[model samples]
Target chain A: MTTALTVETDPAQLCCEPSSQPVLNAVDAQESARVLKALSDPNRLRLLSIVKAGDGGEACVCDLTEPLDLGQPTVSHHLKILVDAGLLEREKRGTWAYYSLVPGALEAASARILGL
Target chain B: MTTALTVETDPAQLCCEPSSQPVLNAVDAQESARVLKALSDPNRLRLLSIVKAGDGGEACVCDLTEPLDLGQPTVSHHLKILVDAGLLEREKRGTWAYYSLVPGALEAASARILGL
Candidate 1:
């Protein structure tokens, strides 16, 4: 014969289990944060906007300076950061450099957060 | 009689027009950057992932610390930042605190980037 009793339970099991579902690993989190950190600036965002709206789907560095009221050097610095983050591509066209959004980068960024 | 001129254009007009389609305004950019800044930390991103995957869409503060290998105070600080950024909501049950993702905030954050 067997008897069952339910007067109490183990104290440890009362605590909720941490979800087994995949969470962001440290390496991926670091990488995603780096990209996001690059985008967490107002000027950088404005630069992306200007480049995105530029004629022929690209904008010369000269055109970017005037709109943001930033110096050419300052705008260039911001653009370089965006370029490094893989969100923008830079091209040299004779005397001036042009910048344009990397195709699908914005969508990829959006997906990063949603997929997380 | 009027003569049509096509040989050259005015010097100012040669530069592309800054986007007439309205880029992110300063206020909105500042606001969005704050939220993204909150997310730009590796620990914070992991915190969000764990909470999102927690049972019944909620998790206790006690459960969060071990998975991230962070101290309770450190985890609390990160949770506070996420809460302040409008990404998570906190509720108190007895002596412990519970956190859940703020509905639609991730979508809104993604929208902020795409809309920009």
Candidate 2:
């Protein structure tokens, strides 16, 4: 899916005025809100950071449980949410699941907040 | 208050490896989650866009109600949440409440997602 929120905008200029390019419309706003909502939890953000910090920019499900003081099931649930939200990608390896940050996912979300 | 999430990072490189810089800790994750949860609503984003698109990058509560297809109270509630999140600033002028984007608020949030 094409992420409209990924549009580039200057960090120095945060607000997008009406006189400027098109503002975030209702449809785009709703879609953006959904992904933003996915990122609204502390455990989830922690999980994302852990997975992001793993070796080779990827981590096994087994390695993620210790850092956040969460169990495997709870951690897996958070990982599932992040995966469904398009922020992460998951791969099945034997009995373990490997997770990685989807390239440009965080940047796209960042762009949406900075862009209109 | 200083915003740790506002630390700059290259957008092209989104992941934060364990061997590299510090990843988002639990405390920062919670703080970031609070602000992110604030941006998780559709109407709120629409309201933000309306305010952001207004003249001088600000808008009045009266002007905001109609375009958003919501009554004054509803719109105000959404505005309050955004304000609490430090995304919008409110000013009292006469009988109306004027709102404007807090400069770099969005960037701080955007920076957080990109940074860690």
Candidate 3:
């Protein structure tokens, strides 16, 4: 079952398996790649960093835009990308949107890439 | 110097500093993004995984191509990319080129992204 069909079609099926065992198939590679690509951007990475470095490990859009120096829309776009990628969780608090890193997103991605 | 010139012009300058303190600058975000982009590919991730899961935590090109189901040239191309990214080390032995994960490559990238 080392075909591309097994690898490209369903990523979640590839990595949702327990981590105690090593990933022995091509499917896992495809799935993990999707996650990595989502985190591969400079803006998205920075967004994650800001959120991770924020007080209580969370940040608002107002706080994030200042350090990024990008337009609010652009920062919002990047945050949306990270949120869509499942690496971040977004919540609207009144007029501002707050984002926080998903608890296990980084660790899960690390495990998938490192096979830990 | 929180301008784009400071962030985009040089990435190494952004993240080469120690990680004891939080990365509060835009430069750190930009440089760390470069490293993350380098590891974003499935082929590169798989290459790292195979090397990590190898007998001695290292693997040769001959061993990598089989698992990847990719041409030797493609695997070679990916290995070169990883090497260039400082995530892998290559040691040529006889007619074979062996690749191993550089120690701390993942950890550093993780620290950059997770701010840990």
Worst 10 residues of 2 chain A by lDDT: A10-19
Cα RMSD (Å) between model 3 and the true structure?
Answer: 12.3
Higher TM-score: candidate 1 or 3? 1
Local distance difference test scores for all models: 0.81, 0.79, 0.71
Candidate closer to the true structure by lDDT (higher is better), 2 or 3: 2
lDDT digits (tens) for residues B1-116 of candidate 3: 57977777553343222223334455665677677777777777767777788768777666777666788789888888888888899998766777888898878877664453
User: Looking at candidate 2, what is the lDDT of residue A104?
Assistant: 93
Displacement of the residue B94 alpha carbon in candidate 1, Å:
0.7
Between candidates 2 and 3, the one scoring higher on TM-score is: 2
Q: Give me the runs in candidate 1 sitting further than 4 Å from their true place.
A: A1-14, A20-22, B1-22
Best DockQ among the predictions, by candidate number = 1
lDDT of 1 by residue, B1-116 (tens): 12324324544356555555327777788898888888889999898988888887888887888887889799989999999999999999876789999999988888877876
- Name the top TM-score candidate: 1
Tens digit per residue, CA lDDT, model 2, A36-69: 9989998888778877778888887766776777
- Which run of 10 residues does model 3 chain B get worst, by summed lDDT? B13-22
- Cα-based lDDT at residue A26, candidate 1: 89
Q: Per-prediction interface RMSD?
A: 2.5, 7.5, 10.2
What would the per-residue lDDT of candidate 1 be over residues A37-89, giving only the tens digit for each residue?
88888888877777777777788776777767878789878888899999999
Residue-wise C-alpha lDDT for candidate 3, range A1-116, written one tens digit per residue = 66977778653343322222224455766677777778777677766776887777788777766566678799888888888778999998666677898998988876654452
